[model samples]
Target chain A: MRHIRITAVVIKELIQLKRDPRSLVMIAMIPLIVMLLFGVGYGGGTGKISIAVVNLDKGSLSWTVLDSIMKTPSVYVKAYANSIEEGRELVKDGTVSATVVIPEGFTEELMKGASTQVLVIVDESITTISSTIRNAMLAVTYKFQQELVRSVGGSSVELIYSSVYGPKVTNLEAFTPLVIGIVLQLVPTSLISIAICKEKERGTFEQLIMSPISRYDIIFGKLLAFFIATIADMLITLMVAVWIFDVSVRGPLIDAMVVSTLFLLGSLGLGMLISVLSRNQLQANQAAIFIFIPALLFSGALMPIDMLSPSARILANLTPMYYFVSAFRDIMIKGFGLWQITWEVFALSVYMVLMMVTAPLVLRLRVD
Target chain B: MEYAIEISGLTKKFGDFVAVDNLDLRVRVGEIFGFLGPNGAGKTTTIRMMCGLMRQSKGTIRIYGYSIPEERSELIKITGYMAQRFSLYEDLSVYENMEFFGKLYGLNGEGLHKRIRELLEFLDLEDVKDRLAGRLSGGMKQRLALGVALIHRPKLLVLDEPTAGVDPPIRRAFWEYLRGLNKEGTTILVTTHYMDEAENCDRIGLMNKGRLIAEGTPKELKRRIFGGDLVEVVLQGRIQGDVIKGFLNVGDLKYKDGETVLRLVLKDASKELPSLLKRLDSMGLKVQSAEPINVTLEEVFIELVTKSEARVRGEAY
Candidate 1:
């Protein structure tokens, strides 16, 4: 751990990275582009689901249900069809996500206080959109029943709901921490994963290891350089999240940054391990994706870890990202303090330490 | 004699393949020792083992009294290595590369800057100090690699094929620098396949198939292959080749120029030639002219490699 040797390597790394504009642009743009994609794609709440409507009943009660479905904020009536066949055609041809049909004699059956069914046809190929459409139609039916009861002068009970996060939390806001977790996890990991392998590929590793520096110096030096270079990535991700998308951070922003820094170091450490293990840049890139895709999928970045099977949950727990995403969510959305997220922070620290230590230990100082 | 590098029974293997085998060598202090071999002859492997860039599978290496792998840190301080390929950071400026390597050897501040300045001037790289190494011409890059290797003023400099692909003039100039470095008392161990270049070494070791087939001064290797130096003579008068062969010292004899010219192998050309000419004068045979024939290292290298291969084949049978 001689400071002078480490400083020398760090300075050399910085100069090389600075001179390579392509890598610099990639570091900045990856986070920006990924965040923008998430913000624009999922940010506006799944973008106005379109469905077709078919009214077969002779009474005006069917139009009331249609009006309620159209009034729901996320639902859009794309077309009106004369028969269930035509409505089904619209859904099959992908003209709309689903079709809502009112059965014949529906208002007559309701007036006699008898059970009636309204049919909804949906395209199940696009599962998310189809499920959303189904939920919207269910809500429309529930509302219509409640109104019918109120008109008859019977007492109606209102179903009220509450959330730990405020009721106004948008989809984008709730998912902001997940986006940050992803940006911090994959971007830095991908960037630093090729550091050592690139040197080895260029034939410079032979010269570098010939110097008097130790294995710790090389590993830690790269860690410091990549950390300085990519901390900007994290900042840009947060800025886009907060200023542009208006993602609210309920707790102190600095606390979120501290947690983010821990996660960032862990990612860099993981990448360093990969870099040391790989013999070439292509191998390093593939290995980075190999490890991170699993982390992204199982670590609750896209879905809750609890939703996974019990054995899969064990895999999620193994990923440092799960704890970071969970902790970031608590800090940003739930307003939890550092004291509440100590376990997450401790787990991240342990991961970072393990990787950072293992990298140098596994790194053979010889090119052969 | 004090040796800059000492090795015995050095062996290196990759899984089941042997790269360097059962090697023994010593490079004397403050002299240029050239390790010469064809491609894949284990020249680079031997250099790597000596410089501690690789670990030998068996045997011992001591550079300047520091045992390798155990005392590699100490060895690193006193040794500078220039790999066969240009391995400096190409993206870095010439000055930055030197500065980085200089600092790695624990050089810093004014002292480090002073050493870098001296090396830049010495290697004639001051003008391109700010140029990126990747942008330099082949010759300049070679010079810069040498400069980086010499930055710390090491006691020993190990170079692996420093002039493999450079043109002739640059190769000559590079040797001049190496000679200059040697004059300053930096023991050099360089490896190359160029036969002419090995002539510049104070001592030469010819390796083929992971074995040091021959080792000596350039002159000694030539004499060893031919059994003696070749000397050609012409006599004007009638002289049977047998008469001269009987008078000559321990040697081989061949005739040319219509029986007047005789080529003979002598124990020592410079010493034996005068007496042979005197013997012809004493025998009433007028001597026309005589000169020692020069033997190129290329011939010696080929002969030695061919003989060693034959021996190996014979043993295999």
Candidate 2:
């Protein structure tokens, strides 16, 4: 409640934070490291589905089918096996995700107007990728049949693909907002979560509370110090996503900064609440991770909330991460300004207010 | 007399265990008051309640004229506390620690800086001003803790076992500083288990089993426990022990040296010994010598605690 007392606490905390090497490294380098990990994991374009092709038919039509399979953007023809056994060996040895075998009489059957099947052998261990490989193969065969019909003089209609942002939205660009939201959410929360508990464990809180300072002074002072220390990492996280990974941001940079500043405050508030409730540093650390994992999973950062069950959707709607990610995506992808994201702004404000108010209420001025 | 701290009916209960029970204590202004007890006598609990660090389950505490827990904010400004443990920020330098605490008490700018310098010099901590608190030796760390507690120049300084674990020389020197502060008109309430240290207190309160069993000056407590000062008297001739027992000022009498020497408990040995010698001379008994025997606080403490325990046992039956 007193400005002098709060300023004293803020100055003391800043000096302590500056002198602590471990915390300094966490604040300076964690965002960059997390962003790099996100870039490496998601920047490679959903990982091309690699498959091996075994051509048994000597006819020109089988070569055309093989070429069509190799030409599909999502599919990669990693190896040309001499026999079906070798192709199956490639899939079995994990060299490729799946194996496609063209039978010996594929062109003859198609010329006689009889339907014949192409055998596809796949390793099912890589569940998601193998399923995607199956779908890619099905599209390849369908396109080859259409080409045969068109060459025989049948009329055809074409389909075109376009994105709302542009005709070509790269994988990294589309995922930038999600990665930024995660970095802003997780790094700052984990960094500041142990602030109060560390004081309690070290016996310093006994001395701290002896001063004529209120709970509001302690909570807000720590909140302000950690915000100053962590805001650098937030900016670096955004810069890494935009400049290093070449992810485009369609809206003004100020809009992103404003949204990020609000989200960072909310994240710091959540960490402060955790710090207040916990008895020690280890408890606070575990609580931060326990709360963050669920937020990351159900917040529509990794997947859409629509794909989740009803209860999970409710959870997604409850977390601040969901709103931040949604708001960030709108600004980055759609060039939306701060005024346009009304729901997200209101939700984040509510989350921030709730955390800042509840932390001091639960904080005990007494050691016991 | 004006009291710096007045506590009545103070009780602290953790579930069914009562750490401090129905305690009443008053520390006068501008005097060193010592709270003495054995381990688990609830000395620290009582001090914590007085400092508003812990709320009493059933009692009222007024430090100076302000009520506790209601006017705790105002009370904190004029009261400084040093815990039993070294509770200052160990990572901070000595000067920084003092500055931080001073500012919290609303002393700032030129005034805060001046007070810090004054305390550093007064506590002989100026040389180690730049050293981290955790890196200081045992004596220096205790000194810094004391320095921070004095940063706001509080009217009342409350210390809970400030000299719990230190060398004899440092403890003695630490008390010397306390004596100096007491001279400056600061009301000090200190708790310690060391009987020898309690001898320095202007008044001592002996607590045992959550109760103040005895309270007085060290000399008064010794007299109270042993029924007054013990004195030895020697006569040139044999004396009648029963006759001496009937003396007006004698509390108890015993003969040694084949009835020639007598050990007598007097109500006031200094006042009565001279008169007794004169009276014996008038009765045709030549007095050899008379002197008051010395009693240590350690002996007084043991005697008082044992008697209280015996009384408690007797009551239980």
Over 4 Å off in model 2, which ranges?
A40-47, A56-58, A79-93, B233-262, B280-289
For model 1, give the interface RMSD. Answer: 1.5
Which CAPRI tier for candidate 1?
medium
**Candidate 1 residue-wise lDDT at A36:** 94
Q: Can you write out model 1's per-residue Cα lDDT over B260-293, one digit (the tens) per residue?
A: 7767788778887787778779888887888888
Give the per-residue lDDT digits (tens) of candidate 2, residues A175-266: 77777777787888888899899988888888888888889999999999999998997789888888888788898889888888898999
True-structure RMSD for candidate 2 = 2.6
RMSD of each: 1.9, 2.6
Name the lDDT of candidate 2: 0.87
Tell me how each candidate scores on DockQ against the true complex.
0.75, 0.65
Colliding pairs, model 1: none
Against the true structure, what is each candidate's TM-score? 0.96, 0.94
- Whole-model Cα lDDT of every candidate shown, in order: 0.88, 0.87
Clash pairs detected, candidate 2: none
What TM value does model 2 have?
Answer: 0.94
